[model samples]
Target chain A: MSFEKQKTDYMPVELVIGQHRGLLHYIIRPIVGDENLVDDCFSAVTEIIVKNYDKYDSSRGTLAAWLTKVARNGALSFVQNKKYAMTAGDRQDAARMEEVADRKTPEDHLIQKENLAELKEALKSLDKLEAEILLRKYYYMQETRQIGAELGLSERAVEGRLYRIKKKMMKKMGGAIHD
Target chain B: MTDFNEIKLEELLKETLPETSLAENLGVINPLGAAVNRVIAGMVMTTITLNFLGLNYILPTVGIMLIYLGMRTLRSGNLYFRLGWLTALGKLMLTTLNLVLQVTPYVSLMDGWGLWAGQAVHILFLLFLGLGIQKAGLDAGMTNPKMPTWPVILWQAVLIVLALTGINSWAVLIFMIWAWVRMVKHIYHCAADLKQAGYVVPVSTVWFSAKPLLLAYLAILLCVMTGASLLVHYTPLDAEKLVLAEAIGVKEETAEIRSELISKGFPESVLDRILDEDLADLGSVTDVDVLQSGDNTSNTERMEGYSVSVLTEDGRVKTFVWFEYVDGKHAGLVDSVKIQYDEDQVTTDIKGRLLYEKKGETWSADVKFEEKSRTYLWFGDITEDVWSISKYSFPFMADSPRGYFTWWTEEKDGSPAYWSFNNTVFNCLRTPLVLPYVELPENADRLILFGGFGSSWGQDKFQIYATAQFQ
Candidate 1:
């Protein structure tokens, strides 16, 4: 009942990661790019987590969902800043590779990098609203209502929009998008 | 050789897959969790601050902090920042409630500049909160932004008018209820989010329950309502008492006069003339001092009394009679003059009217006055008019009944100068009690009798008698 006791009993970062490592990598690594950047982002995220550990209210959102959102924001900030530092030629190459990778191949099941690159390309093609919804839903794995509120739409509206966008993309890929 | 190599590679890939996935998920989840946690911590802290320091001082500071946090959350693309913004909003409402409760007593704080200031602050903050919600929604990519509709705008305008015009306290109460409902709805939405995300939490079910945050809000509300209700109920009584007290303070200084008559000396016929004619013209006496005695030796000694009468401009006469016994014999004069007025006109102005005006020109001759008992009683021709004789009583020396009357007359411009009548009656016993009454002329624009002290026996000791003129 008391926040004071809870505040002092915070789990260590290593232990939290060890316990929920699967969900963390599934949600964070795609947005961050590479193991080294992921490690960097993780440290930053844990620093925030430890510093504001007492602030979390279980009433607002699950600990996992809240943590995922924090990680995503940090990763996005990192990616945006990195994009600015890259040369124009490098940007164009990255964009082209991302686009070409979107084409499906039977060999994609064996090539995790190719699948990831194609997924990122497909995400980029989405409208800003749709992309954000999908990111909050699948990427950060937040609840539909939370995404709806963040976006100022009803929960049903968010759910419908996400469903339609996914279906459209799935049709485009001959139902290969989900797999 | 090829089959052995493939099997070893497959095992290695399976172990690494869960590890990499777990790491990526942790990276995504931890940061958001941290941000949300921080915002919730801020809310709890703010609630505690509000409880300890009171809403007035803490709310403004919290509101400003919330605005800052809202902007930062939008820029940072952190949903948890919205929590700070919402908490700030709740605090702002509480602050407003505090201000309203504090200022409503004694004067209409909602009138004049304070009203405008309060409205401006409310509108500005409302706009800020709306904008913040819209931007957050856009960032999360849920739906198009929609402004509040015309009806909502109109409702807000009405609320503003009611608040500024010093409408009843219930108007403020309605607004408070509205705000509470909205906040509760939003809190429910947040609770739903928490539940969906697999966190267990309970929404507040009772209003003003003893929980820390809710109890604080309830305490503030209770204090305001109790104070306001007391002010509304007791103000008029206090005002009346103040006016009456002022009147009594001035009236106490005047001295009363007393005179006595012996029944053996005055004849019945001569006594009748004095009571009927002479008593009528006696105007504005400070007191009628009376002391009477009877001759016990005379077997046929007649019981004595006095009567007083006043003829009005309407050609009708009004009379008052008093009767009493002296030295084992009934002897008195009812035709005694007694008037009581405050020395200070300011006290008169403050006390206002409290007496009934007597009408007619012919004064009663049959009644008699008594001096020994300091009382008035009927001793007229009892066989001729039993009812009249029984109803009349001697006017007490200490009692003073004074009244003022005015009527409306047409002015040169065809407008009516409405006239007012104010009367005050002082009844004496151990202590004097004053009663006031006022009347206004028909078709007058304004009839104001500023002050009259009522009998202290009434709940309101001073009655402000006023009537508006109508054409």
Candidate 2:
């Protein structure tokens, strides 16, 4: 009833996962298109959520939002590992992760993190509508038709805006991106 | 080449975007935005006067629905929000009934207390809604969450006080509008602040989305309003079977009365179709004179007018302006006729009837007249004056249309009051309804009348006339 009383009732990780499991499933389903793998990716996302539950700071963001980042990353990694396994004679899980670790150097990781911070700052400078379109396309992994429908634009218009936005970001990042 | 893929942009942007923005973009509920909707709905539902195209009815319905939906989203956030949702539902029902009643003429006749009660319920709805929002912000650990709510309530109180005091001035109106704008901005800012603080509420799934629901409501309301308008467009008439026998008997009894009026120089065309009750009232019609009777020199239409005098049982002589249409072609072409009188003239009880030929016999059916009055307020005085004009629809092809008249006070000079005449043949397909444009009286303090305010009350000698010819 009281504000102090409510403050103590911080949400537990299980409750967070329980309430927003549908959201995590939505995020995972797109990347791991296979339904069976989607379930496996969601199970992996739950593991990450529990392991990092203590690190979640209420001041930083919401549980739903934090869970979203964890789910997206977990699902992407699961898909990459699955793809690598297919070419590597269906190698088991730990061997795939070790191979992925070998591909990126520690120095490379540091540079990428720094560049990401700079790109984040550049993103803040983009117009609000452009930022929304970019986030919906890349961050939320929404299809062009879905983005267009939500924003009341044609698919071609959304695609055009996305191209322009990506070009703008590439310039702002000092052409740091390359194939 | 950079080791970081472009896909890392999602990760970077995830951290960069505000939590509420991220949550909302991801299809999560923003409690503050829902609360702001309630504030906006409060503003919308209170406005009832700007009714062009029925916006007053429409906007309030939308506003009530927004409040209901907003409360539903926030109901899980706090107990106050649950109560607010119930109140919003009640307000929606009351508002819907009031809107339906507004389309009927009887709403004007209803007591003012019901309106006051509705206003009270609306205020309660806003109060609970605001409190719910404020409390939700506090529950979310927002600093100074009472903003917007307190300011909005203050402005609402000021407006209520101003309305109660009956202070009418442009300055006060401007100040109130400014306050409303400020309140709306404050509500937006408060919602933004709470959203930025990462306050999200669980949203209940709705069966129908907002736009479809609003469109459906508007469609229903428009249908109801149009149906109500059509219902009141015509006056109620008796079945043909019930009035047929009475009509036959009245014709026999009124034969002597009709002969007397004809001998006194009344037109036989006008006297033949007068209802027996009306004829009985005109029994002592001491005198009759034809004011105008002839074909127009410039046109094919024939015009006939009469002045009839009757001594009331109370012994007061009331002269009546009457018209008779004997030309079958003119009677067939005419659609509607209007009568007008000056503000000083005492005229009431306008009556009209259709005279049509069926199976080689002339028959009559009672037609109703609609009167519209224009009021003129005098300069620097509370005394108001009124001018009147009346019109009737001609539904059938009458062989001869008759019995259009209004009682009028005789002119002071004992001269026959003049009735002006104008005629137009309009293509019904191109122009369905024809209305005359009459200029208003020129007075310095008189309100400047605009287009379509053209129903005119003619010259000082109590001039009366019937206008409008049809094709």
Candidate 3:
């Protein structure tokens, strides 16, 4: 195809998605650790980005940041399904469990809602770098190596910092979280 | 205390983590400023030159480091940025080598190739770095990014052209400055656009942090340059045997001729230094007029003796200008020598030799003529004077008492700036007295010799020379 034709063939959303492919891959790769599964998860994230491109509000957050959240959620869902597919004997029962897992019981919701406020308050006490490290590790599901590469630290260094930060947060939270 | 396990803590943290902008949260250093500094630092390295205290070396070193720092923060933005960062590394290494070269004695030998190589790397650096910024802006989804990369490249080209052509127009300089300012402003605007467009630059970690690295680099460069300056300014002396005339003794061989010249009122000091072959040239000395001489009272510490001239049989006169130091520790060797004479008197028989006192004994060596050609720009036409302006650097034998003896028909008026003088002490002990004399055609009257000295020990030293009429 001619360059002009190729340029014209791309939709605005496709162009946006193409620009953010690396970011999406970064977000999805660790969560979906398997290479094949990462490819599938990246496609799912891009699909969501395309479907919701028009709904994107730049005033609220940047396109890359918004796509990051979407990609993270998509990768996490993919991992959960992959685990269920490998472990569960019945696909229909696994689907039922997935739906039921998405919904919350009243007691669980009440307990989580009460703990979340305290968690947010505890997170505020941590520095920006500490918060970033924790968020990347837990929320984005990035590996220690990936987090180290981003934060300019060795993998072991990142792991040590993460452990210490978790300990600090645990002490600060006290009995706010349950085992 | 509640026994909260690792898995539960991870789940709690993941659930409560804010759903904010990942780019904002992940971005540690300000990528926009880094991108701008990368280009700005490139310009600063190329433009400014502070010669005093090795600032010329230090500033450029710091500027290149800044470019590397900026590249580290922005390399992940795009392929262009990645390539730019790689190019910045190459530029840094090349610049550092050139900086080290500046402080060594080999600078003169490597000057031409080093300049070309430095310019080539600088061009590549600017090209790649500018493109990186431009690409980042375009990829950031700004339709009219108004990138300054091409303009900056064009400006760089113009600068290289100006440098190669040796253009020294104030108007061009002012225009270039204005263009530079405009390019910087454009870079700032491009950065603002990239930020607005939500361009996320992932910063990479360096083994060494930027500020400390720069400070360390600056400190090392300053120390190295200072060390090099000391090495070149004061050439080291050989510590072996200590005799020049004895190693190649011509005094006994030409004792009869030298005695005759001395009887004719020739300075015995000047005659002892004249080589056997040169002593033969002065054999037919029919008349010699020893001029009145005095001690240099310019400063109390340095005591350079006055100039003594002797007329030869062929009407050519030889002048002996002695620069003896009373306080050898505080004295400086002669850096430059300029012989100016009236334009009318002309002959092509100029010879000079240096007699220096080392370890309580006087050793002699012939003056080495340093040849130089300079090309300068002229507005109307490329004149002969501008193309190959010839000059000479008079070599000095150090560790006084030291002095220069020049035999010529007449000296012409010449600018001190045009004189190519090297301030280097000759290793008289290891090497025999090797003479490569320059024969300059006599074409002037009233010869006035000028010697410029710069001492590390702050001792004021100067030379005074006068022409004597043939008796």
Q: Clashes in each model (backbone N, CA, C under 3 Å)?
A: 77, 1, 13
C-alpha RMSD for every candidate:
25.6, 13.3, 11.9
- Tell me the tens digit of each residue's lDDT in model 3 across A83-158: 7777777898779778877897888888787677667667767787777777777776777765654444556777
Candidate 2 residues B1-471, lDDT tens each? 132644554454554454324334444433244445554665656553563443545566777776666565556556766787887788877776665565454554334766666766766766776676666556454545663467766776786787789988999889878877787677666555434332434334444444455668768865765455444332233212224346632666667767777787766655554566666555454544344333321111233455445433333334444554435433221233434444434455555554444445655555555555555556865443333333333444434444445454433444443322222111110011111111112211112112111122211111223321111
Give the best candidate by DockQ: 3
Residue range A60-119, candidate 2, lDDT tens digits: 765656777788778877877777777666566657655766587777777766766667
- lDDT scores in order: 0.36, 0.53, 0.55
Candidate 1 vs 3: which has more TM-score = 3
lDDT of 3 by residue, B32-108 (tens): 44445555665566567765554565577777877776676567767777887787787778776666555444555
* lDDT of model 2 at position B317: 39
Q: Judging by lDDT against the true structure, name the best candidate.
A: 3
Off by over 4 Å in 3: A1-15, A95-136, A144-179, B1-12, B19-55, B66-90, B127-149, B165-170, B185-471
Tell me the docking grade of candidate 2. Answer: incorrect
Candidate maximizing TM-score: 3
Per-residue lDDT value at B277 in model 2: 61
Instruction: Name the candidate, 1 or 3, with the larger DockQ value.
Output: 3
Candidate ordering by TM-score (highest first)? 3, 2, 1
* 10 residues in a row with least lDDT, candidate 1 chain B: B433-442
In model 3, the Cα lDDT at residue A34 comes to: 84
